[model samples]
Target: MTDPDTAATDAHLLETLANLRWNRFHTIVVLLFGLGWALDAFEVTLIGNVLGALRQHFHLGSNAMSFILAAWFAGLMLGASGFGILSDRYGRRRVFLASLVLYGVATLATAFAPDLAALMVLRLIAGIGVGAEYAAINAAIAELVPSRSRGRASAIVLNFWPVGSFVAALLAWLVLSALPADLGWRVVFALGGAIALSAAWFRRHLPESPRWLIEAGRREDARVIIGRIAAGLTDATTLAPAPVVQRVRREVNGLRVLLRHYPGRLALGAVLDFAEASGYYGLFAFLPIVVLPALHLPPARLPLFYLAGSVGALIGGFAAASLLDRIGRGVTVAGFYLATALALIGFAAITGMGAGAIMLGFALVNLLATGSWIAAYPMFAELFPTSLRATGIGASVAVGRIGAALSPFLVGYVGARSMPAALVMLAGFWALGAVAVLVWRRRGGIEARGLALEQLAVEPARYV
Candidate 1:
């Protein structure tokens, strides 16, 4: 009961898409997609780096500051879910640009806060914009890039988070070293917003995903975009027009669809995200407040540690990007997770040791732990079907945001009791993520390496 041309028409378009050689458009997608995530990292790193200064200026204790950080995470959860649904339903372009402006203005406003409460309010709003980036950017990148280099491309893009952190640390150190304590931290925040505002120009040139258009049943629009893309594959490209399959595709509406289809993937995504947030927000975020003070390091000196860790992060990101496509995702994710656990456990064992030993341990944690991010975002983005990709990613990020939101408070409680205990607990979070990936892979999770999204999602299993 099928047209013989069905396989050559809609399915053929995906083949041409997957086979297209790298082009300028692909590079543009990578940089722009990565920027959304980087801004989030820049803001987070700036706040974490400057927390010590904020506490002192506001006359606030550890717990009070923890609650303020929690406010930011709460906003991230709200925005990830809210904008994800909006982007998935309405379109990615509108939400992506709009959130940038919103977060930019909010982050800029944060520098002028009259009091701690005012800063908290602004941070919450800025967080929503950052949160929106996770789903919109990931979904778009997954669909836009060629299938052959998809894993490496996604890894490279998501790894921008570390680059943002590095830049933030450098900026923080420079500002704090030169300016007075009160003015220095404020300037760091203002700069983050200014950088985000500039990204609107590059993002404007990005094209919508053809797969999403086809999935949405916009046949002519999909063909037009695909025609332009196919023609520009190279000077000698002779790609043909994609067949117009007129079958009515049933589109599901709501988060419930994810549960019905990819319950395991959805669950695993939430666990990885939640666990990553717990460790990052709990240990790394709290380190400046707790460990740095113990080491007799000033706030300005925090970037030195961040700088050292970022070296490992850059190394890790590059390694993950190279190794992910070669070694299977299962091996990469598990290997990185296991390495991170060991780093944390090692850090916990030598807690009262000299600052040098502590710093080395933290550096290893950043190298291995942050490196795993290369695989994490891509894994989640690739696992779900095209129709549900944004919502699925959004849901997972929302769950992770819950863990991220709670992590600050939890860090205060545990760190107050014993820093050693906190490190050990944070290690447990990474261990759990490793376990989740292994378990999910065993449950027949599909790897998207060098595979077109249309065949994997839009067609039947035999065709795939």
Candidate 2:
């Protein structure tokens, strides 16, 4: 058992961390970890942008191409579940770094795929890397960042999703327009691989989460890491501190922990992800491709519209980042969902008002709906203990991938018949997600705004 003095000291350690000024190390963490999602967006967005080209090159129809999306999501679910457990059991730095390498190599190899089967296989491999990143990066940032700033820090980290998408759009537009059709798509994949590879080196300097180390009973090690990060603080002069008596629990299987012990969180995460993924993958990401057919827009000018939509995501993401700490998770999440649903309804309302109206609707949905992605990760990161953090988040993301995998097909089919109905269906997704979050909160989910992970960890213990 922890004595009062040691408990106070441990609390001081967290307080000291929470009070540290944002500096070079924090910037490095953001850039390195942020790149994980950026590369994922880049790769996935590239697939979306280049789908027409792939269809032409491989003689695939829309249905077959959709399976490619499904395959990627399948790999994502597998990697998120598998790697989440691995990272929790092994170590964050190793699992996340290796996931990046795996993504890079797979993406680079995708450039050389000789046939459709080979290409699909390569995409699945790349998706695993992307999928693993979601769990690893979120867990690391939540544990490492100061408690007071965890919301903004994590928000900034995840906001890279749009940046990645925008970069992909830019590359695809420039490359596909400038180079030979066959070679341009290959270059885009190569570009993603190279960026991911380059980012891995910088990750080496990142420290293990002090919280995780402490949970594992490595008190001295955790203390040293905290000392190093807080080196400039007036009191952290010691390389080693006296060991604190901590309550080190046996490692539980993370899956069992979520399924049996903290079932509400598991249910909340699954439902939240399912709704967000359905709308995001079904409509937002897939919208640009469908607009030409659904709204009678010119195919040649779609890139400009797509760029505008991507920019909206960035705007909304940053806005959410700023508000997350202020509004608290429950309000922010519930509000975003309700607003996103309304935006989708408005989008459906303008189905035949000409291309301009449709475009505007798309932009609004892009902006408001992005909150789902922006808020989801930070909230998931906050929900579990250090021991179960990665697993819980990974399982959440895995559930998300399942929803994402089916959404494109569902959206494609529905939109082809009636754009209005499709938009409303997407709205329904948002409502479902919002309801899940609100219900979960009522049933014992903590709001987790500015609290430290240590503080948040205590809440679920009561119910679990």
Candidate 3:
């Protein structure tokens, strides 16, 4: 039995979702964001796909490889913190574009690393670019997309990440199969760097955010951009002329301001970050470990399983976009995380059973978990206002990176001690993440709605 108010709220959300559509600029922005996200994912996951080859080629041990992995995560943490502040102080577009170029170059440079130390440094630098991009891109999409479809749009955009990883997996299979031993991993790294350069060109055509422009006291320019966007609105029946928005300049007081004013938002952001980081690393980072064993497949078969997970992730991302408004961010996340927790547990159980069961569970785990994971990013991005959106997201990403950094270590530790227990423990992380979302809901509902971004522009002081 359902409550009337809940039912009415659900109905209204459905109606809102039905009416959701993005202008061309916004759509292009999301597509590019998706592509960039996918490329980033591909680059990061390439290491996992080539870890064995890297060790064999470089005469590296497992311990040394682990250190390299840590270096990458450390770079991510630094980049997230540094660029988050930069996004607020400078502007989203400049920082966003710069980070892309930096990462692209660093990724490409990996192909020529002379030693393990050199590889570590290059990967660390690449991690920073990757880390910085998350905040810039999430902030860009949140500010650009209409409020009614923000949640769904963000989710859909994020879904392309798995596609990138899937592509990497496919490439890994192809290279490992066909390429000469010494040149294979180099090709993978070079490709990551090359693809990242495309983000720069794509971003060039993107206009600076109108919301950001108004905030920075560039009203005239903001108006011009808005007019251009509105010019293409085929259905302008509900559209209004751009109003004169007063500028509200923001300061860059990195950590202190974030801690003092919006403590709850910061806390919520961290919780979401932890949940997302743990779940994502567990599923995608550990893909080769979990899926290959479960399927009893040879090493060559690993990419095919990874490809299946990527397909599931794409489905999840699109499904989230289609259903986010009707489901509401909190409800959708809570439901998704809860289901993911159960699926992870079920996956563990089925893995021990047999090959047929493992394949079925492998697909189902990713199918459920990936969708649930897709819903988190948009909702997480929305939790803070524009003033702290980048910073908050950056801080959250930093905190989340810690969890991600810890996962491989934990997985290794657990595998060393007991494999099944490690599997079950990952499931527990998902359950804890579900609890975090429920806690967030008890404090507040969805972060923004119905022109709230516009309203924030009206009274920027209210947000700060």
Candidate 4:
């Protein structure tokens, strides 16, 4: 149990942090954390770009390729589920740096893999690192940023994902054009490793989250970090002493607590995550097998399609960043999901048109789909308290990865029978997410707009 004095002090420190104006310190935190998302995107895009080369070099068949893909997602699920608990138990800074090193070293090793088995193992390890980043980065950013700008700040971090994807596509094109397929893919993996290591080095300078420190019963550490943050702000005027309500409670197992106390939130997060992952992954799966062939597009030109999709992702991310604070999280996320469903329907209807028309439809669907997740990520981080934030986020991400892993198979099975049915099935996933968010909102879910983390933790849910 928390001491009364410590609880009051924790409240005061949080209030101070929440009221501070944006400054250089917060900017650095966002940029550093954002790189994690970018690196994950780069790794994912690089793998997709190099699959044909890998298949050729290894002389592998369909089953082998499927297993390789499954290994990466499996690693992601395990990492997110395991490392999230570590982050909550140890500290965000330690797990953050360690996960980066693991991913960097594993990816670099992958570049030198002599056999198909070695390559698969390395990919799985690298994926674990990226999965760990999802939990750590989201929790850290939410705790560090002020309440008023948290939504936009988190959205901005998510925006870096598309930037990374675009860079990977561009890099793959240039490298493959200059080198042999075998050497080019190796170089791409090497570059990804170098970038991750570099980011990890810079991240050493980042301070531990004050909120986490306090929750861990380290008041002095929290105070020192809070002081350092305030010292960096130019408008660091003295904050008025705010009245503190005594709300401290005994610590318990986070997962158990989540099940007992926040079942509604856990369900909401899982449903939203599963919907987005399956729908987005399902669309990509359908495209390579069903849509591209119908459009008479060759596999060699897949990079161009990815580049177009990246542009749409960037546009959608920016739109989410702009709308999240103004329109509120629930409304913004639900709206984007609904828009994506409609866009998918339109895309399905236009599949028989010219290549340009089909690509345009594809980009439109990507735009709305990307926006949905960008808005939803902040919600995942905001729904839980500091003590369990990473765990909660990790659990949701793991659940989502399960959906991601199965989406391709579902799409393949359904698409093999009927193209329109596959597209409609993806649309149904998005619609389910939209309905879930709307129901949560109607049933008094927390909005989390311009509210401090402490306030959100203690306040009763109400219509926003």
Candidate 5:
């Protein structure tokens, strides 16, 4: 147990860190971290764009392709769960760098895979790297940014995802238009890996989270980092001197702690994550197998559709960033969840329309889906205390990946029979998320908007 005096000191440090104004340092942190996240998006979009080429080269059917997608999601589940624990117990910066390097190297190697089995294994490894980033990056950003702007900051970082998607779409179009399918796909993966590796080098400059440091009983180290953050601020306020305390290390299982103490938050996060993941992944899966054939568009033109939808994603992400701090987390998140569900239904309804109508529907659905996740990521990070934040985020993502993993297969199975049915199934997932958020709010769950992490860290019962 923590000593009362030491706890007080820790509280003061946290308050000081949380109250700092946004600065160049914070901007740099967001950009670097956001770039890593964008790489995940780039990878996903790249694979989606190249699915036709992959299928032709490997002699695979729609079900086999879905299995490959499932393999990647399975790796994500394992990586998020395992790395979340490691980040909490060890440090965020190291894990952040390590995950990036692993992703970069694995993805680069994927370009050279000789057969179906090799490609599946490489994709799985790359998925593990990207999955680790999901936990570590979200937790680090939540702790590093000021509480007042945490929502917007996280949304802005998420905004980079669509940007990456846009770039991937554009690149896929350019490369595939100029080169052979087999060669173009390899080049895209290689470029993505090279970009990821370059970003990792720059991320070496990011500092460790002071909150995590203090939680680990490294008070002096936290103080030094905090001092550096405040050094160049024009309006910097002085914080209390660090209290001399021995390092008190506790050997506790983060997962067990979360299950025992914060079951509701865990369930809520998982539900929201599941809703967004299924909708998002299902859309990509449906596009290649269902939408392309329905529109009578060639495989090469699929990237153009993604390119168009990415514009909607950017707009939706920015809109979410603006509303999150103004409307509050509960309202913003639940509203987006409900809106996305409605949009998905509309998308399915418009499937019989011309290619122009389908394109418009695709953009609108991407917009709403982007909004849902932009608001949800920060909420997941804020739901738990510093000690278990990454673990909580990772566990939620792991559970969500179950939905993500199955979504493609669901689309392939149901979509083969009925496209509308598959889409409605995805819409149901979003509706479930909306209901879960409403239930949490009615039960007196924490609002979390503009509240310091320390303030939000109280027992769920206390909020009630």
Candidate 6:
């Protein structure tokens, strides 16, 4: 070959290698993060699915079980807030690893709970771990991915929640109901503990986010980790090093810093998150009761209802993942919430009208609303810069978790009075969430994917 032709070919080969490396890096991050997310989903959603068993085991009623679930979410709210601040201050690496251990130990402890009080305490601790882990992992993913692909990547990783929840539902059906009471729930708790080990394994694969590293003024360390990550992919060998990142160190304050500066973002994050939590958790946490009566199934058959909803959630997650990249984040989230609100209202009407409608509407609402919003985590994380990414997201999640924690209590309270009233209340919450998300998009930018990671790395004081 001519010398000029040889040079062109070599350049093309290097370019192809670079593209491959980038894709591999993206895929590995998503899969590792997704695995952790799945475990989180399993623990969080398991409460709803297993409520029947717990109620029967404790010789309690639905209202009491709702209280138990609420306690878990309350703990989640506190955990997310506290751990989010700690993660940002100490580093995602330490916070992430610690949360895994905390939740795992808590879950194991749950298996040995002798009474409702013991169960509630263990679940609260487990909830804290689950809540904190979500903030840490989501922040980690937000920092790791490039801006252009952030929405899609976030959607994909977030989809694992349904995957884990569905798997847990299936296992609860196969294992919990069939086994003796003590053994059954204990096994499920053991599973939750076992699954948490994935966090440790997952952290091994993840290096500190380059964005976080840059913000911390560890450019050399960031560069070395990036090189190792690059080498992990079978694309480029002896690749050009990533550019050195220089970031300013800023005085770190807690929520006060958020209140003083970027109040707009904080308000936006909190309102939007609160709405989502209310809508998502309100319906999801009550899935068993919603479906059990309508399906006309025996107590033994109730799990099938959960299993179906879980499938819907899983499918919805995958569908959300598929469209997140193509559709704008604002449009996707608003559209889902809007549709969900309408569908839920319709569901209440239909179910109130008759039995057949109840069965159908219950399935549709669960599938669409819960599944669609799984993609929102990335968009939420993107709303703030790196310095407060965890804090912002964590605080929002904490607020939302409060809503979630309350949802079951709200449902049980209303259900005792009237089922139709409960459904109407849920529809209202969904509408509220839909409105909050729409307003957020109108005020903020339309395309959250365009947000640069470096911008997130900007100190809180200088954020623009």
- The per-model lDDT (C-alpha) reads 0.78, 0.78, 0.71, 0.81, 0.85, 0.70
Whose TM-score is greatest here? 5
Which candidate has the highest lDDT of all?
A: 5
Instruction: List residue ranges in candidate 5 displaced over 4 A.
Output: 232-252, 462-464
lDDT of 4: 0.81
- List model 4 lDDT by residue over 1-464, tens digit each: 67888778878988998988888889978887788788878887777666656766787654465567667877888888788877887778878989999998998888899888899899889879988988898898898888999999999998999888889878877777678878988998999889988888888888788888777667776787787787763222232221112212333367787777787787788889889988987776666555554565544455666678889999999999999999899989999999999988888887666777766877788889999999998986798888888888889989988987788777767877777788889999999999999888888888889999887777344332
TM-score, structure 6 vs. true: 0.86
* lDDT of prediction 2: 0.78
State in Å the error of residue 349, model 1: 1.8
Model 2 clash pairs are: none
All candidates: TM-score: 0.91, 0.91, 0.85, 0.92, 0.95, 0.86
Mark the 10 consecutive residues where model 2 has the least summed lDDT: 233-242
User: After superposing candidate 1, which stretches have Cα over 4 Å from the reference?
Assistant: 1-8, 230-252, 458-464
Clashes of each: 0, 0, 0, 0, 0, 2
lDDT of 6 at 442: 64
- Candidate 5 residues 1-464, lDDT tens each? 88999989988898889998888778877888889888889987888888877876787788888988998998889889889877887778778999999989988998898888998999999989988988999999999888899999998998899999999999988988888888888898899999999999888878778998897777877877777776632222233432323211342477887777888888888888988888889888888867776666766788988998899999999999999999999999999999999998988897777778777888999998998998998887788888889889999999889999999999988988888888898899899889989999998888988899988778767323
Q: Show model 6 residue runs off by greater than 4 Å.
A: 1-21, 233-252, 289-299, 352-359, 444-446, 455-464
Residue 305 CA error for candidate 5 (Å)?
1.3
Which rank order by lDDT, best down to worst? 5, 4, 2, 1, 3, 6
